[model samples]
Target: MNASADPLVSIVIPVYNGSNYLAEAIESALSQTYSNIEILVINDGSTDDGKTERVAQSYGSRIRYFSKENGGVASALNMGIEKMAGSFFSWLSHDDLFVSEKIVRQMDALAHAASSESICYSNYYVFTDDPADTVPISLKGVPPEHFRYWLTVENVLHGCTLLIPKAAFTTCGTFNTSLRTTQDYDLWFRMAKKFAFVHVPEMLVKARSHAHQDSHKLAGTALKECDALLSGFVAQLGIDELKAGSGQPGAVSYARVAASMRSRGFVEAGLVATKLCIKHLSGESPYTKVLALFVLTRGALMQYITKPIKGLIPPSVRSTIRQWLAGGTKKGPPGAETVRGMGLKEKFSEVYDKNIFRGSKSRSGEGSDLVQTAVIRREMPRLLRELGIKTLLDAPCGDWYWMRHMDLPVDRYIGADIVEALVAKNREEFGSEKIGFECIDLAEGELPKADLIFSRDCLVHLSFADALKIIANFKRSGATYLLTTTFTARTSNEDLGTGFWRPLNKQLSPFNFPAPMLLINEECTEGLNMFTDKCLGLWKLQDINLQ
Candidate 1:
């Protein structure tokens, strides 16, 4: 294939006595859809006669061949980096095959990227010799820039899955020759600090899993290296990174990381990580402390249960078991269960008990996705500042899952819900001197007084009479203002009973709320844009017609 103006990406295959699959690996590099590329085969010293050399020679001038003492993969890779003519570098293991479109797709992604040193990786397939055993792994859908934050827990990024710019190697330096087991990740960690890595979300490489791999043969060494790597990584890990990566408080993620380290038999490293968890937990509110404790308990439970069960599985069926588990990672759209023939208290009780609103990967539902709440999160602080609002009453605050991550500057926060059990859980896990949880059913009696009522995603589910009763209750509370959910695109109102739901335009018909003081678009992207213009509007309570 003729070269093009596009930047050259060197496909570097470092082999050590790998004639068994060297030719296949070379063939994959040659078959790339991207034409602006060069193939470099580094035959790291092989003691298996000249079989590996013959394999490299058979490729002729199609690949640039070089041989050296078996210094290790890191050394071979460093030699390839020094000798490669391409501006970009891609490492292809002698045993792994790249999908035909890997380079071309990554090149297309880089064309749109703003930074020059930015590296890119993609999802990939892992398999044994049998093609039927292939399993596609999906990486979490985080934006390219934020990947480093989440990389704390990500272990699946294979060397072959990466298409890296050569400049990154120059800037971050090549793989550590001294490290035998973790050179790729060690260098990647260094580069991750200095460069932005993009995730392409497409499966671009098929990795071969075999028993002869170093990780399988030298398990002790690999575990030690992994623990060392984690030791350094955990040392630098701080609250900001955890919050950015997980959208949760620092202590929760720290405890999880600690639990993960301990479960892997790195007891000392795990203890250090636990100290970091405790350091962050120090002086935090009771809510955060309880939440961290809850996370730690859950992690402990998982460790106790899964570790034993994993051991009990037969080696013969481990492959089948893994395949089944890989398939289980995918979750379908959450089913919205019907809550029919139940009382006001029983209706919401069932909703919480059954978790009927499990709409997104988030436990609270799709209404609470970080992206869905992005607009409102940005707007809330400003609204609070402008109104001088010191306290907030979050009605029907189910789970407090998404909101707990938010940093609201309120003097006091009262999370109220209809489910008594949910309220108790919230109070136990999230209540503190400045934060509180209450069992409240708005359809009934007088509401608690607050500077403003931040009632979101509430009115749409209630009957028209119940909504009126809640609105009257809101008025009776003598709160200065209300910020609540409304679908502005909705031209008319459709009334439903307490257990059912449809979009309601508060400005129309029976409600006829005046033009809102502020219409903060919820930017509802939950389902295929069906609920567009669903907004949280702000209004002064006295101006609201309570009749």
Candidate 2:
């Protein structure tokens, strides 16, 4: 298209006593590479003795300036939207700056994409002082279709990064005048319903975060608005929307949404999601629901309730009491009794206490042997270097025996184990600022975001059911890669009790994992060197086939 023929992008700068940063925003807009643009400065009742006015007037007809009554930013933006002649609308907060290529890049994206979604947004940088030090906030690795649902989880979008079609305001209606702090997001939530937001995935806008910003100044009001906004968004939300948005199963998505709401201090909103979470969980089969209940509650229940109670009771009486509470556990047929009421916490503790895996009682078993770990120790560092792995989560990091010996190319190392005593020991002995330890059950507890999850020798002890939960936990953790134990030669998979020994082939039957990106064989000596096929398979968590 010719210069004039190209769609005009109207950059709207709304200011309320923002004279200090107004010039920079205006300059950034004026410096845009895309020529077909108009900069409209809407002076939102700035009371700084005409300072903001002079900034706009100094531009001297290079920009269009308009003064409005002392309404909030929403009203100012609405005025700009109504007056602009451009086909597209871009909001530029007086303190925020657009990259020179912002409009052109988004315009190019719109022209090239086959998608019908008219609203376009890109990743933005949060800056305090210099642009170089700004931290980029990238949205979830989801398609444009799920951005709306993802909005239900959390708001990571910035209004300045958006290049909304002018017609979108006409179709979805302009921003809610009543909403002061949450006006942009309220508008976004509405726009998302009518249109899928196309994420450009480029740092197009530099958003300033200062003590003077509205977010900091109006913190109390913002919290109230956030609660109401999210409550309204998630009120009548469904399983399918949450499923597609979170990329998790039905009940799991609701559970996540509930947890997210709780973290944000939106207790009422969390209760709403929690209600839906329970509603969906009730629909599951009786046994599956029971299993979910145990797995979900085990970590917290054991740690907060049982762990303290454990100290009071003798070790000999604890098992008998637990079995009694669970209606006296009877050994059912193998594979049928996959969930034995006892979870990873109890099972791993028993293994540690009894030396069931057959090493020393103080150690983590034969699996943590220096010789057994030699292959991984040698190969892992190089692989981490290649993948640029920074933060690593070694779940079920048993006793820290073999890993402590290796020099890993990692920035942060988190060793998580279900056994509380073991985690405490590891923390007291080896825990530092860089090397941390958390007591978490992979099948139940949350995993922190890391570059890689080194789950060596972890899944082999879990049943297929528990293994599925662990893998799902890995996905939910937002971690990139999973390095877990899998037997390459074992084509057939079998389900076992959680504590029992079984060769798990992640690529086979129940798991149906894709071919690993890399596999490092441990070169087995178990059962007189019988299990030579034992190896750790590596796969991107995203590529794992959940079905």
Candidate 3:
């Protein structure tokens, strides 16, 4: 096991009732351009569809199959890692796919960097079937100085896209089996504390989004886990240390939890939490006021009762309680209006105006960077330039900041979004003549053509089928280069925030595209790969001819 020897990249795929996509995920790994790879598919107690034997047999001798009673994904991953003989270890979710060059690219990057670098990851694309059709975007690279800071706030590495040296496992310990959620985030956070991180700006993986995925369900449980993890970290490392390592803690963590609950129809619990958050900000002492209010609220109390009651109190009574909750609902769900009415355009505007574009002077004297605008300004130029595109069509361009910050020629920019207000604002700022803004619904109409079709962080809300149709539409638009960012399958219950967790439909299938497709690159950003596996990368259109 000499460090200089040819490193064996062991791909550990943990499967649990993921039989449907298991073949695709395994095929994606075996198809990797990098040679000297081993596939270990650990089946974690799948009882529903006993396709484990069939799946293992399909791969023949290429994949080693291990069947164990239904332990969680983390347990299965740990089992695979323990048995892995490769110098570099990477894990892919059974439902997720990877670009052929993912391992090779990451291995090369790791070999070139200093040995002290604990982990290296590349960008990835999030594939969905959503027809609402928002563009995908990636987070800009954080300075080495800010690496620890970025990681503490969120997991910047996606497990599926991550390649960690064996040494990292020795130092960081195994994934926390007790943690049903946030295990990857916890592992990466611990890794960052001890080692430097490197980023490869390539689309190396595709995190499949579908109905049966864990992220769609168990959002509340995931949120609770994340909050516990964060609180634990704060206690162990101290809030000052966390703030020093990561940037200031924004409202996203809390906001996500609240949003998750609302989406799951836990309206009252979500609202109570939101009010508590507001109260805490408003100088409410003893914060117990919020907790007290939550306990007293009928909705919150019902939520507390439903879990145990459903399990112990019998199905007949549970159904009655559910009916009652639905019937007696007051004050609606948290962020419901925000969720229903706000499209990608509106949400982006809210995030931009309230946070990113606020023109808040940098206290650190790092330039007049708006927190939100800084990520776009620094990353867009390089990303666009790397795509070798002079022209870009920013579909559903919420605010024109992406266009504004891009260094491309004025005539090359075209912006279309559903928000008329934002579209009008864009016309006023960039002038309707130079930058074209259209009020278009990608779901219903035709899209404008361009060299590269760019979108960012816009998929999750739609169903899987709709996401695929959107991609199909993108291909039809005659765009050669497609760049987008999305969440990974590793999303935890905590990651969903307050959103009610729904398990992904087990029957949901992967998007099928013709071959000779070039998957340019993929990476994980946004603290952790909870919701989606990988983020940020350039992809070449393969199956569709953009003529």
Candidate 4:
């Protein structure tokens, strides 16, 4: 802890209106076990009736105080960087506290690391009001190579946990001021690219997660600005032949941002993001660019076709015609009963091929494709927006034809299906930062949690027993709502030669489910003319009071 022998560490606390906990944050840094530490509090124009300024003034000469005009956190940090008198830099937020031994342990790790340029960070504890609520976090299995990939998906690194060498700043530069929420994330990515980040898997800081934090206040606008900053960062990476399409790191990030924008009704922003992705990916993925344009055009055609078709034929007649064309009385497909008893994974793998929807028959809604593309394109997004759903789990995302065009007002989209090849192709071609694909057998495996579970025309293809099991899984999946279209004939579960068909109401009947744990309320969709009895049921689960 000798000042002359040890590297001087600067603990910069950036504050705005953080009068409540600023003193506590400052004291924690001053009491650090590593004595050769300088504490600098940057007051980024606090308008809290001079309260924050007073708090810093009370610290006086013990902590260096600098007051600047109202600037963002990035600017305050940059100012601190310029004035810091230490070779090692650490960011201690005005609301967060550094453990007494945080620096001592980090320095010990760096000494062993033997790399002058290596950045060191440690796990931290997240707490609200109660000490019992503290959760120790350790980022496991995260080496430097995988760090970039994991960071691209989401920012996992905690800011206060970081202990950066001054050389890293000189090499990678400081935070981006334009970025609101993800400035720390941007800086991490920049430094990670050039320097190795050594992880200390021990809790070295106490991060406060409170209501008044900047992140919580600007929650809605944060993602939009973060994506904007990320788009610019990726653009600067300069795509190469080796970095095209999903393989291109920058392209992958852009596509994800675009998908999120599109899902949230920011069509123009999404289009711009898509354009950026195409620009980076076009050099190596010419077909992918063409495919994007083709999907756009096909969406327009489907929208137009469905409008006229809806007007010409009544929905009931359309339903009747569809049934008759499949030979009306067929008992299901040839091996329907055999497939019914098969395991969900094997059954879907054998029957639903990767390119099943690419076939002309599936595209034109021939057999088993009960919900029309028009219904999905027109109704689904509106329904999602109306329900204020921000996350969606679309199982059996078949070709994802209608979804590409729909204005789904969601923040996250996960496509899960039983088809392995289809899931792989989706991961390769369409996976982005906010969008992902997983191969899951609905009857056997657990479903991802979301605000809504969207499975249309999928459950009806299963036998009554298997379908019931799937329903039970959905209830256990912690989803609030299920938006699904069930094939109904006011009858019991029967083999209609196309697959298993059952009455929509009967399947969702409260009496059919287990007691006390599940309370399902079903409401049919109105204004859906075609296949009127082919009802869209919104089933809401109260909760699963698991005994």
Per the 3 Å backbone cut-off, how many clashing residue pairs does candidate 1 have?
A: 0
Residue-wise C-alpha lDDT for candidate 3, range 1-547, written one tens digit per residue = 2335667889999988776678888888989888788999898998766776577668888988888988798899999988998877899998788888898888788778765565787777655432122123355666554565465444445668789888888988889999987888888778877766788888787776543456434444665676566554433443344334534332222333344343333444455445534433443344444543443344343433332222454434433444345442222232333443455456544544444322335211111234333334434554465456767887657665434544554247788776667678778878655567777766555888788887654443344444566777887787887665532222121112222122221112343222311221132211121112233334565543322
Q: Which residue pairs does candidate 4 place in steric collision?
A: 315-530, 331-497, 332-497, 332-498, 333-497
Instruction: Estimate candidate 3's alpha-carbon lDDT, on a 0 to 1 scale.
Output: 0.57
Model 2 lDDT tens row, 160-274: 9888888888789998989879999888888877776787988999987644556534544665787788888887566787788777667667666765565444555766776
Candidate 3 is scored at a TM of 0.47
Worst 10 residues of 4 by lDDT: 514-523
Residue 53 shift from truth in candidate 3, angstroms: 2.6
Report the CA-based lDDT of candidate 1 relative to the real structure.
Answer: 0.75
TM-score of each: 0.54, 0.55, 0.47, 0.49
> Each candidate: how many clashes?
0, 0, 64, 5
In the range 419-518, model 4's lDDT, one tens digit per residue, is: 7876887788889988888888887788998998887777666656666667778788889977666533222333323344433333434324222111
The regions of model 3 sitting more than 4 angstroms off are: 1-5, 129-137, 155-157, 237-547
For candidate 4, what is the lDDT? 0.65
Clashing pairs in 1: none
Worst 10 residues of 2 by lDDT: 299-308
All candidates: CA RMSD (Å):
23.9, 17.7, 15.6, 17.0
Query: Clashing residue pairs, candidate 2?
Result: none
What's the residue-level lDDT of 57 in candidate 4?
93
Error of 3 at 295 (Å): 27
